[model samples]
Target: MTKIIKSGSGKELADARGRLAPFLRDTLVGLNYAYYEPPGAQMLHNNAIFVRSHDYSEALSTEGEQPWKTPRLVSSGGTHLAGSLADLPYALAWVEQDFIVPESVQSLIWEDLVPSLLTGAVLPRWWRVTGNELHAVTLYQRAGEELLTASAKDEKLRQMVIDILSDRMLPQRSGRLEKALRAGRLDQVFPQIMPADTFYLASEFRRRFPNDAEHWGPAGKELDDLCHRFASEVSPERLSQDFGVPHPALAHSYSRELLNVKPFPTFQDYSSRLLAESWDSNNLYWARLTDEMGYPPVMLNRLVPQLTRRMVEKLFATNLDDWPAILRAMQETGEEFRLGKTASLPKSEATPGP
Candidate 1:
């Protein structure tokens, strides 16, 4: 078994610093290493990471003009890892010098994330804006260059769903997950982790009453909200599961807190899955599902938005087709959804799949 070193243990903070110091040996001489932890958004508060230099106190210093925009140092040691930090950079300077970004990759430093990193907001997850890249903020995996950012995870999840709904047999990617999604069963997805078939009833309740905030609360808002809760960091079971708890939204929020959101100057720093990272760039990540076999992107769009919306409304508001009429209407729209509530005769009279 491979052993890993942790940056923050109950062990003395000085010992933690001592353990981390050797990793910075090759970095600049005067460069100091700063470990960061954010003030979490626990009721009436906000979660944030602020950076300025290789020191935490200065990066978050209110004594200066604007503490919120301060530029803070990226921590060197991996949280639960144990090994050579030899390949890791000592400070933000090393992060800049060693940034590994792809030539074709685009940095999405919207108005919110970039300026914060410039002054001192050290975010640590998929969308975290850093000096040169929006990295996963990982440590143990970087020396080997196998970082799987959250955007990559979301893309994979989307692809997995499409693959399951494709209906036609193809190369098997995740057979179990595909099967579960096809049958609309979440219990099979993680039976061991989640012992009970809890969400099945909950999800049905939300679908039936999408706006029943009084009882369902946030889960009642949208199906996606329910999915975000139920479908947390599932692919990377161990690492992500550890971070998945508390709630769905909080699952990957602290990926950076676990490691540094380093700048990968090139694509080589990313995992092989980075090739699929182009999903966001394309307007239709689900285009293949729609174009090839005729499954529209989940979001309503100009191409055939009304058709999908009408189909959805009919599925809920209207009765099941007693004749071939509704079947023809569904066929015309080209959606993969089933008429679950379609009316049928008794078992003796009605023959299925006819």
Candidate 2:
């Protein structure tokens, strides 16, 4: 007669321990278990033991000098035992009293007990737990799939996974990311690049501190004026030389007009171009680019306010000779030309208010 033998719980436990033993060994190595020795130069070399007491009468109480009068002993000692000697004093009282529980069985009990004891009344946040678990499982599955699927094929997917992991783990700052994005370098390098969620978060932060514009110092107002001039049909190359490279989109928008148009471009046209191109009317990109191009903030700060007025007059003047005259008039009058503030000029003749 043929008989079938069923695998017992002990067999299952053994299989689990076989899998977890390597990780446990690694953890022990990390904890410097090899160098660890008890106070009396006693080396722990045996399997872990666990003891349960139903009542205080069954539990052994110990103190001071020799906590365990009788040292715990395990059946067939190999490595270290990981249990309190006092808790299992009955088993320790006599080596013959202790029975061998499979390492797998011990591990299973430890796995349950540790989490149960550590996990108190409060549970980890659901999102955090889910994210960590999902990330781990995802990476594991991906690695397994890559190994299996790419064995007979090209190594593109495997390489991609490696690259992604390396890049994701690399230390990168969002400020640098923002700088790249704003300069359009990210889009240039990776054509499909989209602005990160961090950009919107930065925008929100700027919104919260609107007065940060004031702290931009003199450079901020100069950048605004330069952007206004560039948007109003001023030659981008000249502006680029004088101020800096206008934003690609902004420069493109301004260059669409006839080669030589008189009276330059209106502030309304400049404002419209800025709005249409989605460039920040208040926070111009040219100044940022100038700074990125290695111009010192302090020098740019001093130059920008003066340079914007010069560039505006240079662009708006009917003839090149008119610049000296306009500059002379500006020098004579305390009022700015852009603001239509001249000492001799009448209030009625000034540029109309919005």
Candidate 3:
């Protein structure tokens, strides 16, 4: 039996305190749960219930900058909070299935479709813009994921999605990997060190030593090709190929198999699955950054714009006579600013708010 749970302004929230009481009472009784509603605005006293939650502390807010942007449930025993947007029903379904929860509930929440409207509350402009390559990489990966999920029906389309996703995702780790390579960690730790400086070092090495190519053979050549391709584009198949593994049949299976958890199954089933999952992961990362790193959203936001401006300024400052070289450097710097580490500015310079 599909249990229909309807939530909205008219049916979910009412002006009469007495009349509004029973619906909450009934919802809790029907689901074997308890309910809570935050205080309404005093001025209009319009009975605008800002938030609602189950007895277990599963919360849903209708107020604040990013109201519906936050989780509906902060799992009591878990570190992660479960949030959903109406735009990404497939993601909600994936979560429900992965968690072994009732898909009915997932459908119900989505049918209510409160999150889509909440975008007005938590606008994209609220996402603080900056030149952080990591953020750019993340955005690219997200956009790629969306593209992939939406293209999943076709094999060629899936491959294309995987290619773009993998490519953008790779450069995100370049700063750290490059640093490690420079520090000679790869030579000491990795079984065989490639002559190249970064993640695709093996490819560079293979390129330089075609005679030794027989040693690595088809597998090595494939890996080298995969890595080189990643420098330009990426996808689940490419990611799997790079890891010398097969792509997973199941969607969103990151743990049981690394290759399986490509976020979107075929790269065409966008239906909100990837976005919801990605947003959950991103929110958790952001939450940790706030809790552990002491970097609040406001502070993080202020830092990015300034850092981007500074990076742009520095590109112009370098005294270079060659016009083409200068232009190339500027373009590279801009790309770096768009997709690199220098996106985060010092905390001291972070603005509080407008």
Candidate 4:
């Protein structure tokens, strides 16, 4: 199914031999798998099998004077597997194996066992059996665009795609979000985008850890605890109904924002826009948007703390002149913050207890 004699330079052929394990070197002697250079004079046939590197440098290390076979094989690519070993870097061993092992047992090793050892194979049955949505989301990300595109076409992938979105467990952009939109299943996806508890969890995460660095304690045990607690409290049907789904307009706007539809404007305008949108639309209009589009309060509050000095500088400058005045206005009065429209802080309504 694949060409046995691929063309390569004689030097390249030599370099490939240098990388081979001693066991492989000894076993695969006199195998001229490559077509040499110099107009094909006397064929300087290399006595070693050369395969295209599939990041197998460690596997081919000669520390033990043998090919570095893994003790237990696990797929690096989660559920991504090629149709054949001939399609993989393992193809170098295909012809070579026949020389060492008998033909009768070759298919058993090359076809069945070797493919299982390579990446793109499904996760272990135990891992799948655990039914951890987070793990599934990880696998989905590792699968990358190939899995995502396939999800649009394949029924199993489509179902898995829906499940991933429905879980709403992934914090990062996992392409499941985009896939749901493209597949015209936003209705299924949007309702669960921010689970009811997500508002609390996201808010708590933001509140308890203003500095992002503090939240990540030694492999993220601190964050994991919060996530575990949130997971325990999540009830898909109940929370979806409580939080409610966004309107078509809000969903479209939010999705566009996530996908970054428009290019970023000039520094000041961008900064002003972010502050205005976050505080005005999200904070000041939280109640209104919740009523209008079923937006969670978390959406309103999440960006407030993010409007730091560093964020401003990253956009353009060290500081925007208007930011201090804006911050002062926000702190002084819990009202819509706009430039040059100052309002006195309103008095609190409290009845005196006699």
- Work out the TM-score per prediction: 0.18, 0.15, 0.20, 0.17
Ranking by lDDT: 3, 4, 2, 1
lDDT against true structure, model 2: 0.27
For residues 135-244, what per-residue lDDT tens digits would candidate 4 score against the true structure? 22222122222333445556654555444433333433335565664675645444333212223333333344445433232223433443356553322222222222
Where model 4 places Cα greater than 4 Å from the true spot, the runs are: 1-223, 232-275, 278-321, 334-354
Which ranges in model 3 have alpha carbons more than 4 Å from their true place?
1-260, 263-270, 278-280, 292-354
Per-residue C-alpha lDDT of model 3 across residues 1-354, encoded as one tens digit per residue: 012224345433444445657676545443321111101112112212212322222343322234344244344544333343322222222223222222122222221112211121122222432223222222322332232233334444334333433432344343443344345454332221110111232232334444544334333444445545554343322322222211112233322112222222112333233322221122212222222233444543343323322322333312212112222323343344334445344432333221
Q: Worst lDDT window (10 residues) for model 1? A: 277-286
Lowest lDDT block of 10, candidate 3? 34-43
Per-residue error for 127 in candidate 4, Å, reads 36
Tell me, by TM-score, which candidate is best.
3
lDDT of 2 by residue, 212-318 (tens): 34322232334334435543322232322222212222344222111111112224324322322231110122133223333333333333333322222322234
lDDT of each: 0.25, 0.27, 0.29, 0.28
Tens-place lDDT per residue, model 1, 171-244, is: 34245545554554545543311100112223233344445334322222333442455443211222222221
Better of 1 and 4 by TM-score: 1
The TM-score, computed over Cα atoms with residue i paired to residue i, of candidate 4 is: 0.17
